[model samples]
Target: MRDTLRVQLWPLPTLGVALAVVAGVGLPRLDGRIRHDTPPWLRDYLFGGSADAARSVLAAIAGSMVTVTALTFSLTVVTLQLASSQFSPRLLRTFTADRYVQTTLAVFLATFTYALTVLRTVRTGEDGRTAFVPQVSVTVAFLLTLASLFALVLFLSHLAREIRIETMMSSVHTAAERTVRRLLTQRQDPADGEPAAGDPPAAPPEPPANVLPLTPGASGFLTSVDEAALMKATVEADALVIIDRLPGSSLIAGTPMGAAWPRTGEPFSPAARSLLTEAASEAVRTGPERTDLQDVAFGLRQLTDIAAKALSPGINDPTTAVHALSHSAALLCELARRDLGPRLLRDDDGQVRVILRRPDLQDLLDLAVSQPLRYGAAEPAVLARIAMLLRELAWCSTPDQYPTINAALARLRSTVDAQNFHATEHGRLTELTARVDEAMAGRWTPGRTR
Candidate 1:
């Protein structure tokens, strides 16, 4: 029951001060007036006594007002602080509702009620000896009510600001969810080798008997020699070649089954062999690194798109957007580390030079690889953070100056081909390539709704 009431009264803060004043000041005055000029027992029981008692009651009422007012002011300050910390200054600037008007109304009603109570206490008989001046209490109550109304207005205004923030955040969250779902749906799956529907049928296999024999020079005298002679030759030679004719062909039982080719050239130049070995090793190492880089790049692109959507003026509150951007950035860095490894060293210009075997890049590799997934898993939160960061970055210059992911991609594209290490390092080299092409064609506008 308590929880239900709490939920039902969730908007209490919006009119809390006004309600407080009505109950605290008006109710007491009204109760007292219900039994005017009562007997001593009735006065003590219902309306209390003379002006002295009314004064004490008014003091209590004033104290409550002061306490609530102080608390409201403190709450306002605290809420503002929290909002500032959570949202950008630009977002905070949008909240400009007036609080004073509501507070003024609440104070006016409360004070008027208090004044009425005091006036009732001071009423006197027609003799004018020591009559209670109900009018005096009414006047005091009127003034106090005005004061309380003003306070209430201020308090309600703050509450309104909070409500506005929540509304904006809710809108942003809905927009972000929609955007994410759309992007995820639009993502292109990796290409697999599915044959085209119209491809010609595979050719039929040849019969086993159709196989050909090796060249005469390639074949050995084993085909013409006796098994005993071939065995003697094999024992004498470093290697022996043998060949066999198909079953339908005429071949003596003494003929060898297969032929061998002796290695004649200098086996392998040491330098050449080493080069071949190293090339193979490098190929083996870089294949997966390239893949990781591509995946990370795709993730980053999605993140950027999410951030851009969150930052749209209509969307509100970029908390999730900002988080997404940070996450994507971390992921990109991780992929770079995994693929580039020790080769990801910083050059003199502070650019990351992917020298595949360089040792100096280890630290950067470690830092870059460790971040993205830890923070990116919560897509909504990540996107919010990204949006906030983008807003902050946007404020530094004109909107045109905003450093978008596309811009970075364009700059990189201008200097390198799609096959370049940096380009390939990001998992979606093809997507990035497409983006670059689209950007060059003026099709990659950032603020486009989708």
Candidate 2:
């Protein structure tokens, strides 16, 4: 629900419209009491026009505001299209969640609604009715029109900057960092159900003979899992639930997403099994697409998509790919310093009741580096960036995580060895590999090999 509201464009604007309606209805009543009681100097600030003139002004403001609102919507749609076509479609969320765009739309629509609402209260001396005009309401509407015009200019400038590639990548990087902080922790003790700081990892749990399959309610990417609710259900049924699907994995309706079994060495009763299945299905949430709520890899995947698309023959933007690699490397280094292991949810007794799968360092490394390594192999600059990336990761990685870094480093070395480069290019890459070795050995070597 939180992710849905964040990526939507309507909630804020609808709120603005609702507030405008309330203000429009109530402000005129206040104007009726104060229209004729204004101080001598204050009267100069209020609308001094006749009822007919007030109606004309209100109608003009209403018409212009609605027209501008349409224009703003068109520009927004164009921006979304450009982002989806040029960058990854996942970036659309960044734009849709922009407060500036939402605020601009809200201001415009609110101004239009207010003006139209106030226009109906205008009266002229006819049929023995006294002529009356909402002086303060008209002035407020005019002020809103001015504010809307200013917002229009600011929105245009903002849209211009947001469409740039650098701005888009930075936005993605910031979001990814937040996700990393929220979902991962600095190397923790394995005894506490976290990835070991320097200890040998625990072995995977064996499957029970009598396990009950838990199917999803619908088909989509698994966005989140309600661990607390799962823990409650697990404790009540005295069972252990293992969810194999990570966030961003595709789920099919009626397919086994996970399994549950009695925590004790016993089988579940038929009635208890049915109840467990229903609760498990409700605990896992799926959506039409992936969200960064709990998916650490979603950010990396978006950056990789940009790099991959840039390297495509149609685009052939190696410089962009290199920049994307730089960002990916920073995120990878951050991930390396943390524990990337499956999450274990324990109950009050401290026994693990739920196991949620998460990507390890090796999996994230492949996701972040493999595509660029494949597509950007021909570009020396890109290869150098990838080499630098591995070196950075090696420096931050713990000893237990060293094997994964070394494996990635070996692949980088193999890629460079296969390339028929000049002596200078080959030598530079060799120096980079040496630096990775030095980093892993807890040493820093400063100087060019040349």
Candidate 3:
């Protein structure tokens, strides 16, 4: 939980403040020493440029930088708002996670701070005979002002491009694809191949008779589970542990994080039970919001949310919906080639220690396409794209996977059959359905996939 909290904390502002502090203290002092120690003539030639003029320049730049930084922040907030309204609020994570945006904000704020810090040191000595000018520091601030001006332009350009529908869809697609790959790679049984429909991995046997529930101290989404730590904890308690909630589950106070049962007939000791519970809690990490760390379904949900939002009555943008569906197809295609099984964690001796219910491939496929199709079935483009999506999944996946996609196609066909459509559109959908039906029947070239 501590590690999760650290990652969740926004670091850019802190980084900007640190950079400002370093520049503010270091540059001015260096410049002041050069002014006092350097030969007067050469200093006049270099460090001794007009103290009054440098001070005025630094002050102007400092004030202007403050205004520019404020403007940048305002525009960024507006962009975030527009993205949330137009796409899904879930997508705001992608925008916030953007390094370019964070760095841009950091640069502008840091530059402003640097200018203000050095600007205070530009004053001359009280005596008319002596003038103290940090010429080098003032020059650095002036250059920083120009760089910030350039950054302002870049941020505006980035803001414009980053909010486009294509960009949003692409970002979600990229994240989802990466997540699918990561989930598939972490599977324990490499040679088990993909799971056939109706033949899921056998469930671990029922819990031991004497069981104790372990409740978490905090409430949030379960971000990750340290399986190794959990297995060790189960061993120490001489018990079988079952995690009731999966990684993506939103935790509630007093809810069972999981339950443990003693391996032997003897019940667990209070001290042993307490230590076991503590270890279990430590193995699980929760946070305020869902992340993609061990939650692939969260990424799938993000795509569908955008598609569903686009198909809403207030915003009937079929093109965006179609675009989202297309990427959903891409992610599903990747998922098709991998096994989707509930993970059963075991100890070194091969005894089952933990059972976790992961989201199956079929569940993800439904999430990726269900709501979008329900909202978009009437639109010709969305209907066509969904049909194409089903065909691709049907063709690319294993024969056992065919049944699930075929059932989805059956659902689509039933809905299309019930809803009235224009003659041309109806004819187009009918043809697509025929092709998908053929694919589901295994007519496609074998060993070929996209």
Q: Give the alpha carbon lDDT tens digit for every residue of 1-450 in model 2.
A: 878998899999999999999989999999999877889898899899999999999999999998999999999999999989887898898999999999999999999999999998888888578788999999999999999999999999999999998899999999999999999886553465433345433544666866899999899999999888888888888988889988899999998999988978688888778778988899899999989999999999999999998999989999899889889999998887676778888889878888888999899999999999999888778888887888788877777788988898899889999999999898888888888888888777886532
Per-residue C-alpha lDDT of model 3 across residues 338-360, encoded as one tens digit per residue: 65756788887988878766876
By lDDT rank, best first, the candidates go 2, 3, 1
As for lDDT, the candidate ahead, 2 or 3, is 2
Quick one: best TM-score, which candidate? Answer: 2
Sort all candidates by TM-score, best to worst. Answer: 2, 3, 1
1 versus 2: better lDDT goes to: 2
| lDDT, model 1, position 177 | 41
Give candidate 1 misplaced runs (Cα > 4 Å): 1-50, 91-129, 133-319, 323-425, 428-450
TM-scores, one per candidate? 0.29, 0.94, 0.87
> Cα deviation in Å at residue 161, candidate 3?
0.4
Candidate 1 local Cα displacement, residue 391, angstroms: 19
User: Could you tell me the lDDT of residue 134 within candidate 3?
Assistant: 76
Residue 219, candidate 1: alpha-carbon lDDT: 25
RMSD for each of the candidates: 29.3, 3.0, 4.1
